[model samples]
Target: MDSSPHKLYHVHGIDSRQFLEHYFSDEPDMAFGDDLLKFPIDSLRQLFTVGHIKGDILIDLSLGCFIHHLYSASEFFKNIIVLKANNRCIMELKRWVDERTGAFYWGHASTFLQEKEGYSDQFGDKEGKVRSAIQHVVKYDPEKENMTDPLVLPPADCVIIATLLDVISKDQDDYIRYLRKFCGLLKPGGHLLLIGCLDTTYFTVGKDKFHVFTYDESFTRKALVREGFIIDYCNVKERTAVSDLVDYKGVIFIAAHKEK
Candidate 1:
């Protein structure tokens, strides 16, 4: 089936005028268009300005909408590293990133890089070896296992970016610990960009069920502090309500500098 056309909307809670003024002034082309989800892209643009991100190493945690943003700004990254707890996202990102010119790596958060089923689809023609080109693919369940040691990968001299991975309010402690481990993946003074789903309900993808973790700015701020990151900037915006559909509520974006 053809992929659903990307849609954009202004989520409810945020000040749309201020958000547009702060981030989308130039009217950049968004992967999901101008309406559906506006907070993430705008926040990203602002974060990119706080420090030097061009030619930096970006570690993207969530693969759905976040991947689109990374691809949208492909020219700026030196290497893009993607980690997804979800198998589908990992596969999708690997395919999308491989097609681009920059270096791309994919795997689970707890594990480094290991191949798994449903990772690659059968292709009639082989332009490049997508499977073989993968340097590392580790396998580990974030909830069940702990990443005792950081996965060894290529060194990144610049920033590390991740989003939509940690914001489950109920799992606050666990999420904070996870965030620390994620920070360890980056170099000291490296920038960490994060986008998280705020108040929302349980949603299902295939057989997997995801529960919501309602989070506000204060909670996130404290978590960042505990994780040893200096808050560069943060913004929370409510996702515009879609009639008759499950309400996503809102999302939060944070750009923090890893303390040296």
Candidate 2:
């Protein structure tokens, strides 16, 4: 039997607005709102508050233009470097940073984070803080030996990748290879915070389905260990919301550090 028609994120271009509306929107009915937004934001809030992940530079290589987690991250890391797989994503993110017209509104996300952290107001400044903390937004080539060719970034103190690997990786080997590349971006003992799904196969954006590598929690731990990372924290949230856009069994948050 033929599988559903779909596109590979690494090859096919994405519609940034459609992608955000489908997966990252704050609408209560959106299937992935909790899994993609609230879960990671909560986890990052705790992790950053514990005082272990702070640094001068934090590299963000997440799946799309989402920045909910960065509101918490900006408070800890002085400089944020965003790396994207395509220029479209880069431009979309830049639009938000520059406060350009038609930029996707993330106020709902900021409000969500603030409420959780016991802040009642000042929602207006959330974007400003993230924009100021964001030092650079650059494109990266995952196929290149140096993901950021011609722009050698100093090894970061921390790297946060959310829902990116499973979409970009085709197989277990590809997962390991990309994990190694992510490791290369961190300094010795630098922390790596990864957020993605477990046992997922596909996710839809707009009208096209996109591939998501199927892997469970154990495989992820083994992959990180093999890539020279010492796992420090891991959390998994079973599928709670219902949706046909993606068939993910659960969401996962993992924190690890490169072997010093």
Candidate 3:
């Protein structure tokens, strides 16, 4: 591989299914699956269960079509609106939401959440609840004044963003600009949950290297504080799985509330 900067993920026509298989699949051979998938799910479950983040409407703007974290989110928020940066992600998520043929399997994620919550024989029910809670999944443009045009959304009570800022942002300033935009979507004192990788410069999706802004835990905290967020909870898990697919040092989950 040349020393060229990673190509932008959006421009590369990322394959949503391939991305999931490489990062989120539960197969035994997928070494980084636990770090990329289960870690965030577990962290989100812990944050949602701690009882500080409360809301009726929760908006998710995550990387790709991943919905494993929403299994826990659906339990707390009555209304979930998922915003995707592209139609491919939207369509892929809808395939699962609609339970269409050939949808990617998420039973492992559902089962993990079920076991964590100490529930039995509720995997099917959990999936249904998430599907019902998600009222809409729409494509959005970050540059637009109204990201969700023709469909005005009420200010969200809570917003969850997972590994997306790194993909969309071009620099530190761009990352902070996007944070301000997210803050604008929330009500006063609304909560924000962020999931990201530490010191990661790129990720691979079907042999394509996509750029990811390199950032650290301290930088994330400072960025959040600079964007007028009061950090509430933060957890960072060290990278244990070794993979040549991506060069992430660790994973970080931060829960914060926007300053009123």
Candidate 4:
């Protein structure tokens, strides 16, 4: 249990190297060309192959940098459903994806499309025909959130992929409950792909702030098992040189499939 900061940092560096090797290696042929985009798509590819995903509804719970990667690789996906708390991220994703595949975009603040009608006014001053492909945007509150709420979702046939699941309290029990609620969003045998800080303190995104629940592989795996997901495969990768301004250093990649 050597928790010395220097020792931990060194270990983190080594783990990060290993992760880069596995993610960047060309031999696997599944390697994503960009370093930033590799892990999410690679993990998704693994899940798709292992779980036999095809022509299935895919949902991204939070739209971050990974959302772009998802859209770029959308040809391989059956249908893309994206969810985000930020209006700007949703709009950007919508604009980008619509330019490529005519896929719609939705956010918590603006409705690009509601039902069959298109809300072109919502996307003011944008070029190109606002495709019916764009969907409604509604307000999302992670606190007191449930998967069963009709107003909060699209359909049950969606695979839930969340880039960050840090809304719950840090206690293990609370974390388990949050994951259960996330899983409840999908249909039976659907999959859940989660990416977040494994055992870290806090993360800063612009001026916004967030904290991790200090999770490890064993704790997360057990929680998923309790939530009715079979542990298909799990990989933990560390991030080194995260920032020059701060000494921050922990990140993990986790992928799991929902069981019937």
Best by lDDT: 2
Return the lDDT, model 4, position 225.
Answer: 81
List, residue by residue over 32-61, the lDDT tens digit for candidate 3.
767877888899898889877767999998
The residue-by-residue lDDT of candidate 4 on 1-260, one tens digit each, is 12332222111112322322333333334232332344444555455544455444556565242342342223334556555554544554555546655323322112212211243444432222222222433334445555323565644454544434643335677677656766677777776667655565543333223444566667777777877778656776555533422223444456566767
lDDT of 1 by residue, 1-260 (tens): 22433221111112223322222233343222232334444555455544465545555554232332442233456455555444444444455436654323211210111111123433312222332233333333444334422565444433333334432324677567666766666777777777665554543233233445555678778988887888877777766544222235566677777778
As a whole number from 0 to 100, the lDDT of residue 135 in candidate 3 is: 92
- Select the stronger candidate by TM-score from 2 and 4: 2
Error of 3 at 159 (Å): 0.4
What does candidate 2's lDDT look like per residue over 40-152, in tens digits?
Answer: 88999988889988989999998878888899999988999999988889999999999999999898889878888887868767778899999999889999988888999
lDDT of 1: 0.46
C-alpha root-mean-square deviation, each candidate: 12.8, 1.4, 1.2, 11.9
TM-score versus the correct structure, for each prediction? 0.61, 0.96, 0.96, 0.61
Q: Provide the clashing-pair count of each candidate structure.
A: 19, 0, 0, 1
What are the lDDT figures for the candidates, one per model? 0.46, 0.88, 0.87, 0.46
| Runs in model 2 lying further than 4 Å from the true structure | 1-5
